[model samples]
Target: MTDDAPRNSGTELQTDWFDTIRINTPAVERRAASLPSRRSLKKEWQAAWLLNAVRCMDLTTLSGDDTEDRVARLCAKARQPIAPDLLDAMGVSGLTTGAVCVYPTMVAAAKRALRGTDIPVASVATGFPAGLMPLNLRLAEIEYARDQGADEIDIVITRAHVLQADWPALYDELRAMRQACGPARMKAILATGDLKSLENVARASHVAMQAGADWIKTSTGKEGVNATLTVSLVMCRAIRDHHDRTGIAVGFKPAGGLKTAKDAIAWQVLMREELGRDWLRPARFRIGASSLLGDLERQISHHVTGRYAAAHRLTMA
Candidate 1:
């Protein structure tokens, strides 16, 4: 983070991206001090392989964009048992128990509908997306999400501070957010696109991990630049480095722009390869995409029928 940079340095913006289909993550420092040994890492990796999931908080807009239809569609999808159909259709053991993530306002409804099922309620809290709000207000939001029965709370760090080279600012904010979330698991979103550089991404990831974030996320999905393999690698390196030192395993989430099954699988593969086996579990990795479910569904349908499904709520775009 840098507070010393001159104004309008294009320092606040990102540039260029991979146009090729191949996947590549940025250079990262490996060897997490807190990570486990080879055997334990294998067990953890095997447990997490191919576990695709969703992140849907803020489906409803912040500027009064109601997500009733979106929620309805998701609820309808959730009500239908997926494992049997998905298993036979995709020729795989079973699809991951994809949770219907939501905001604090909708946590209760998601919890109520998804009850007694594998799907869990997730909420975006603590001034999510743009964490520029007051701290007390953010804490209240976290409390509200938990009180409403959210199993997870994904909060954003202050982009402005992180850009200012203020590591303590980033750390303190996440520490506060994690403390406020109480028993609910906490995910700290880096909004990597806004960070603009691999160095910043690495720094932010390390600070967040150091401050006790359960997971380090890439984007808010509301930005022009969503999660990229470059940022994901940077964060993975951060996780690896932190684990090497502390022996406390952490997680990574490459969210936003993740749409295709190919995309999901590719990221999953990279995470497994880079972090080795230990970081593959649900405890260590995640894909946060609102539209990925339908894409995966279509692909599964294609896998079973030898033809693509006619349509789904969200098809490949």
Candidate 2:
């Protein structure tokens, strides 16, 4: 329940922060390509690792059709995460996802539903999926989400800024967004799928951290591609490098296209090997997924009963 992340101060923009950045595309791709075979578990070990992934998951509902009723149900699922009987059989207690993520408008509904628990409600703000809104409006959106009781604000950065190599503009915008978030932790989404190169991804990661982002996220889940392993390698390495130089830890979230229990473990491995065991915790790492939980529960059920359960056997998460 405790976190090692410190509050980020939106200090004056740092120039020359991205001066020494270099990303070897082929090397990153090679490591990412070999990632799947590198880590594999079965039975008890697989179940245990999936449980850890559940603890670090951000159970999310970001559809346009999301409603208060749906948000309530989602919060209920977040509170329990897995079936009580399954958890009991496994000898686990107090296991929950890292948080529930939703649109800014649903923050209050999520907050009300998650009341009386430590589970935080995270809202995607700053023109989510596309950070093309005016800077003023994006800043206002952060404050609006905060006032509505969002404990965390996921802000998407402008891809154009990175494409143009405009580090100063990106730094100023992220710093301002961090300030706007106030007490709510700020998660800067790089939207790496649109950033076009590993080098751009690394530079954007550094800018986000320097601008006081508590976490650096991979995507908005709306891009053509989201949360690829090669991109994750680039971003996680940036997180490690930042911590090494500045002595500040930044969280990492790989959202979108992560559905299987295997995908969860792959990301878990990436964090553990690249960032260390400390980053494996909910505070430092989160799998931003909704359907992923269903697969995890299904796998856990098989582990417990020695048989696979039909998808319908588990409630829709």
Candidate 3:
């Protein structure tokens, strides 16, 4: 989806929307486990799915040592994610990763590097990995990134609000962040790992969407746990529920710990099975990872050449 699409205007803080919701842990686990086993793709079909995953990926680099050079190289990779020969072998042309994600300070470098392309530069703001900073500082951070030319701002939400079941507080904070985002789309990172329960995940998802989050993300990729199929399932259901009530579509992003080709396919399967084909696009779905492209290249190469390429043979992400 483009930035021009109608955004979720959000609704009043309706506690009854998710107040009595209770998740069945065993059932959710069973369903998540069954997905990979049930759907099996092969040969050309598998190749196509993997390519779609590439189109939906948020190719990222968010290290403490990240630099302009690193972000530039990452932008280059985003522009041509797959090798020309490999993509040509598959009869594909003009393929690129969904976006290039970087830290706030790296936004300008990324924007400059990706100057001619439609690819967006996403920045992690609002005390990423830990939304423990004061609210004013977080809002200012969002504005700073926006001013630096970030197309999307991924903001971390305060886990305390969800942990304490303070729905109003969460809603208010996210609303302010949304306003701060201005033209830059706001993605609310729930950090589901810290929320503790599936019920909390569901509730927080509702509040975030109700607070005008364009997308609800799974994690910061710095928690003890990040995106898991189970947690993602809860978030997807909440997204579906929000759509059901408001006639608005909110995006879903699964970040952290997604490192393999299999991980890419499984999450796509989840999105397809749960939210339909619309959610499979980059505008709606994004897989946030730093090393996933390497394995994806390996697998796609294996499909194209009938032999897997060594790790070093592929361009690094």
Candidate 4:
């Protein structure tokens, strides 16, 4: 799906949509655990899935020490994620990451570096990693990132609202952030690890979708636990439910701690099993990780050459 595709135009604050929802923790955990063990792709099939994961990746750099030079290099990686020789070996061409995610201050640098490409620059706004800032300032930060040429704005939601069960407040804040985003797509990061329960994750996901979040992300990558399969399953079910009711597909992004080629394939399997092939595209699904690309490169190289290369052989993400 492209940016031109119709977006989720959100509904009013309807507490009935999720007020009575209750999560079965053990069942969710059992299903999430069974996913990886049930399916395994091999050889060419594995390579193809990894390549798709590459196309759906949010190649990211969100560090306090991030600089323009680093953002430029990251954008360069996004443009040509796989080495030419490897891509040729796999019979793949025009392969690039879904987007290059960076801090709000680095959006311009990313845009300049990714010039002349279809890749979108996604910026984490609204006090990312921790959305504890005042609401006005957080909304201003969204506008700032949008003005800086961010094609997508990843806004972190205040976990307190979910903890306190203030569904109306959460919906109102997200709606304001969505308006502030203007033309840029808004991704509401629920930071599930801090929400304290699977039920909270499900309810938060519903609220975010109802408030016009183009995507519901699992984490900000700074939490103690980020993007667990169990948590992701709950979120995906909520997405499925939202689509069932509204006939609109909201995207899902699982960020933080997703490393290795196996991790890449596992999440894709989860998406395929839960949301079908349409959600496998970049428009509906994104895996947020920095080192994941490097590992994917290594695995692809091994697939083509039948030998593993040194980790240093691949370009740094």
Candidate 5:
């Protein structure tokens, strides 16, 4: 190879860059046309949309003492009743069982309590929040999560492979993880912040869906690389193109760094505008979050009780 020829590492030399990945999407401008008008997006993202999309909250913290008991209680709290403040805002928010997402070690406890309820258990597999580990170890983690009865498994894609534009390797990893999931649904985490470009995000989304991923996620919420509008737009377009071509719909989950009620709505608005109301089902979209629940609770309390609750009261353990 000449000096100007591309230099690739051992693994990079193994992939075929010319292989066909048959996903067809509209031009970028045309894709934008499918999205909601800026005025409409702004209007729909009011406090109302945020409140409605609070059905799923992610309790993904790993460093904890009462792992079992704490996760059990969080799931319990979700089922018993939401604060009237939250209910008033979303109308149907109360009486819903939001999922309890935890690490594999706590998967058993979470699944044990959530077994019969509508509330599902989510386990982070594939070396979670970071996809830097070896393939076998990640597969083992997914199998363990499945055996532990997790209803859903979220796995981070191989960033090294993805960033290197190794679509086939990424697809194989997703398929392998899916096999490890058994009956549990698998979520493919793109860790968008790390991917760094819309084109990469789009290609990753396509490769993930083609590889049997039930959902394509935005971030791990652990790495500082959380979700963003550009990634979401690119992902939604990918989802649309996939459905249009094959009639199989892939879901989207924007995990990490979302805090305010506004944050939730912004994502919802993006989905609502790009994917339409049908994709709004919990199955098709989810906000991978934890703190937003308390924020929603505080807002609900203020709306119903008519008194401003102290931030301290709402931040209860």
Candidate 6:
């Protein structure tokens, strides 16, 4: 199914048009700070939430030392993210991550390793992280990754455009990248940590959606400051606003720095509370992390056996 296909194809770019999204910093921070204590789940409920978190994770490995063998192992882990016995005992069937994310060069390895499975191979394309390369080179990277069987393209936006308030340039760049992606879903990484302000985050979210991004992701996971609940709230609210106007649901991915079962549940609650229960699914929300699965597996083991397993016992691959 192409449920993740670009939601706003053929939509004209409206650079000057966006809802007035004023963000109250103190209020947003307070709300984010209150989240940990306000929401808590235990035992069966906590395990169930963690399983849902796993199902919605974009299992990722974007390190410099990532090799085909490493990607193969990552893909294998994606195929069976949790221990089979534990999964069976927990009564969770057919569990898998939302996708397997890797560098563009690793797409083929991941694709081959994950064959016959529904898990999409997501590639970080378009001069990822920095996005300082020329437009042609960036666009070509998207095409190359697509040619190599990337089901989803995670393209980093030119942060300079946001910094300079060059909305039109940003819009044009993303539109071309979307066209290059062909049928593969395109996720515009705003790198919210770099955007600086909540207003910038909201605006970038709008511009990316206007340019036909299937998803508006928060970070490249390389920034000193990665995904935060405050940024996520801003971006998700932007998504909610866009959906209300366009009747198109764009997926949200909060990548970087998200670890532990508690972190996953916190994000789940944010999605559920901000965008409703529908956004809690893999189709609408994804958490990107490399080590998050290990922590989640350990938590699940604790839930099932009533004893916490050492972190070393879990295999993140």
Model with the higher lDDT, candidate 5 or 6: 6
Error of 4 at 204 (Å): 0.4
Give the TM-score comparing model 3 with the true structure, all chains together.
Answer: 0.98
- Model 6: per-residue Cα lDDT at residue 36: 68
State which candidate has the highest lDDT: 3
Which regions in candidate 1 have their CA more than 4 angstroms from the true location?
A: 1-64, 67-72, 79-86, 89-96, 312-317
TM-scores for every candidate against the unseen true structure:
0.76, 0.97, 0.98, 0.98, 0.81, 0.96
Give a tens-digit lDDT track for model 3, residues 133-167. 99999999999999999999999999999999999
Please identify which of the two predictions, 4 or 5, would achieve the higher lDDT against the true structure: 4
Quote the lDDT for 252 in model 3. Answer: 95
**Candidate 6, clashing residue pairs?**
none
RMSD in Å for all candidates? 10.4, 1.3, 0.9, 0.9, 9.0, 1.6
> How accurate locally, in lDDT, is each candidate?
0.63, 0.90, 0.93, 0.92, 0.69, 0.88
Give the TM-score comparing model 2 with the true structure, all chains together.
0.97
Task: Name the regions of candidate 4 deviating beyond 4 angstroms.
Answer: 1-4
lDDT of 6 by residue, 1-317 (tens): 24643366735776555646578999999998777666678879888999999999998988999999999999888889999989889887899999999999999999899989889999999888899999999999999999999999999999989989898898899899999999889899999888889999999899999889988999999998999999998888888988888888998999998987789999988988889998888888889986888889998998889898886777865
Which consecutive 10 residues in model 2 have the weakest lDDT in total? 8-17
lDDT of 1 by residue, 1-317 (tens): 01121211111111112111122332232322212232232322322232343322122223245465555556556554243554554445534334556778877776666666655566888677787789889888998998888877889888887788776666677777777777777778889889877777777777777677777889888888988766776678667766676667777878888777556666766676678865545556667765666666665555455677567432321
lDDT tens digits, residue span 1-317, model 4: 26556898899988898999987789889999999877779999999999999999999999899999989888889989989999998788999999999999999999999889999999999888888899999999999999999999999999999999999999999999999999899899999989999999999999999999999999998899999999989999999999999999999999997998899999999999999998999999999998898889999999999999897788878
Residue pairs in clash, model 5 = 58-289, 85-300, 85-301, 86-300, 221-256
In Å, residue 67's CA in model 6 sits off its true spot by 1.3
